[model samples]
Target: MPSTSHTAPITADLVRGALDLEPTANGILPHRLPARARARNTDGQLAMAESQPSGVRLVFRTRATAVELDTLPTKRVYIGAPPRPDGQYDLLVDGRPAGRATATGGNTLTIDMSTGAVEHTTGPAGTLRFTGLPERDKTVEIWLPHNETTELVALRTDAPVEPAPASGRRTWLHHGSSISHGSDAASPTTTWPALAAARGGVELVNLGFGGSALLDPFVARTMRDTPADLISVKLGINLVNADLMRLRAFTPAVHGFLDTVREGHPTAPLLVVSPILCPIHEDTPGPTAYDFSRLGEGRLLFTAAGDPGERAEGKLTLGVIRDELKRIVTQRAADDPNVHYLDGRDLYGEADHAELPLPDRLHPDAAAHRRIGERFAAHAFAAEDGPFAQAEE
Candidate 1:
C-alpha cells in the first residue's frame, strides 16, 4: 500500500463567512463588531482573514451629547450604514469632517446572520488591508440622522494591538444600559464597561444594549444560558425612561430576572448596578423628548415618548426604580453570598452631575465615562476578592 498523506479539499462552504444575529422583522440586526482582525485555516487547506469596518451598530440606544469645547482632533468617528439622502450626518472631530464613506455595493459590510461575524469582500483577496486611522486617544464624534435606522458592523483603531495572553485573568460578562453600550462615548474601547474591563485585567463579553437593557425575561434567559466567571447587570434608567412597568410589576420582574440568572450562575460572583444620577428623571416620571429644531438647523425633530399618561402615572422614576433594584438585590443577596449590589450613584452622583451634565440629561459624556470607569475599577475591582474578582482556586 502506498503511504498517503491527504489534505482535506476546500469547498465553497469553507470559504464563506457568516455573522449570526437574532432575527428582526426589518431583516437588519444591530451590532458592533469586534475591533480586531481575525484569520483561520479552513480544512488545513486555505486561510482567510476578516477585518473590522468603519461602521458602528445601528440602534436607538442613546442620543448625541452636545458638542464639547475640548474635543480632540486626532480621533475618527464611524456611523453605521451610510449617510441618508439628506446628507445630514455632519459628524465633526475638532470641528472637521472625520471620514466619509458610503455603504454601497460590495463595499458595504454586512453582518452574517448565520455566524455573527461581520463579512465583506476583500476584492480578490490576498491579505485584505484596511487603512486610514488617526493616532491613539483622539476624539471622534458621530452625528446620526434623527429617526434614521442604522447598523454599525465594525470599528478600527490606530492604537497598537496588545493581544490577550493565552492564559491567566478572569472573564467578565457585563450587562447594562446604553452607557455600558458606549452611548455618547467617543470609541468602543472607551465605553465604561470596556474601560473597566481593561483596568480590571479581564476579558469581557459586553451585552450592554443601548435601550434594550430592560429586565426582560428573554434577556434573563440569555444571561442564564451564557457562561462567564463573573457577571453584572446594570439596571434602572431604561425602565424609568420607557416607564415599562409599575412598581408592583417592576419588583417581581427584577426578582424573576435575577432568579433566572442564578439558575446558571449560582456560585458566580454577580453584581447588580442601579442607575447613576440623572436630574431629569431623578424625581419626575418622564418620557423624555428633545426639541432639535433649535439645535440641528430646524431640519430635524426628535420625539421619544408620546404617552403622557405613562409619565403622569408615577410608575417609573429613576429614584423609585433604583430603590427597587437595591431592595431586590439585597433580598437576593441574603440567600446567595456571591451576589452583590452597587449603587450607581456611587460611581456618579449629583456633584459629578453638576460638573459634567449629560447633554441629553441621561447618558454621560466622554470625560464622565472615564471617571465612571476609573471609579468602578477602584471600588468594584480593587482587591483580589472584590465584587468583580474571579472565583478562588
Candidate 2:
C-alpha cells in the first residue's frame, strides 16, 4: 500500500511575517505591505520591492519525514547584466536550519535599465521538496526568498500537519531600505534583521522596501498602525541616494514619520538607526547612478552623480543625516524616554568595511550581512540596556 500524502491548504494562519495575504488563482501571494498602503503608491520599484517577501515564511507542525511545497516565483533579469540566481527556500525544524532548496522554473521579468524597458514572460510553477526529517512531531518553517516574488501554491506532507502555536515572543517591527530587504544576503534567515530577531528571540515584521525607504507618509502610517512591542526605523541612505529631499524637508519628514508611529505605540521601545557606511555617498550628495563604465564588463557598480558642492545648498549627505538623527533622538528622548538612536556605523563602520567591502559599492555582501547581523544582535538586543532588552519581571 502507498503512504497517504496530505495536502494542506495555505491559509493566513499558516503564514508568518506577512502583513497581508491575497488569494490568487493557484494559491496565496504574501504581501509585506497592506493593500491600503500599496494603493497610495505609484512607484514601480516600491511595488516590486514590497512583493519580494523578504522576511515572510510559512510555519506549521507535523511528524512527516517528507514535505513538499509548490510555488510560482517572479524572477528579475537585467538585460545587460549577469543573470540573476534562483531564489532559495530555507527549511527550519524546531528553530534550527534543517535544509535548503531552490525553485527551478518561474516567471521572468526582463528589464533594460538603460532604456527603461521591461518584458514579462510567464512560466510554470516549481516544487521544493525536503525529505528524511526526524519522525517526532516537529515545527517547520519555510522562509521565502528575500529577493524574489513568490506565490505560495500548495503544501504536502507524508503525515498530518497543523498550524503551530505562537511562541509568545515579543514582536519587533522594523522598517528600512534594501539592506534590510536582504539584498546580496545569502538567504532570508541570514538577513541582518532576521538574524537579529533570532538572537533577540522576538517575532519579526520587516518593512524593508528596496530603493523606496524615502520617508513616505504611507509607510509611516503603516508602521504607525502595526502592532509591535519594539520598533526601529532606518532612514537616510534612500533619501540621499534618490536626492529626494534636502535638509530642510528631511527634518520635518523624519519627525512626522516618528510622530505617526508614536500615535499607535505610545510607549513601545522605538529605535532610530542611521545609514551604514557607503564610501561614495559618505560626504557627497546623490542621485547615485550606475557605473555605466563597468556595465560592459558585466559588473555593476554605482557612483554618486550629484555635485558635492550642492551640500552648501542644503543637499543631504550621510554625514549630515547622522548628525541630524542623533540630535533629533537626543531632543525627543528628553520627553519620550522609550525612544533611542543607534549609529549605523556602530553596526558596520570603516574598520569592518575595510575587511568586508560592499561588493556593489552600496549593498553589503553575504559576509557583511553576517557581520551586521551579529553586531546588530549584540547592540540592539543583547546589551544590558538595549532598547530591545527583555523587561525585568
Clashes of 2: 0
- For residues 173-230, write the lDDT of model 1, one tens digit per residue: 7777777766666554566876787688775666666665767565677678776788
What tens digits encode model 2's per-residue C-alpha lDDT throughout 271-305?
A: 99999999999999999898867777777988899
Best by lDDT: 2
The weakest ten consecutive residues by lDDT in model 1 span: 44-53
Candidate 2 Cα outliers beyond 4 Å, as residue runs? 1-4
All models, RMSD in angstroms: 13.9, 1.2
Reference-based lDDT, residue 186, model 1: 56
Candidate 2 lands at a TM-score of 0.98
Estimate candidate 2's alpha-carbon lDDT, on a 0 to 1 scale.
0.92
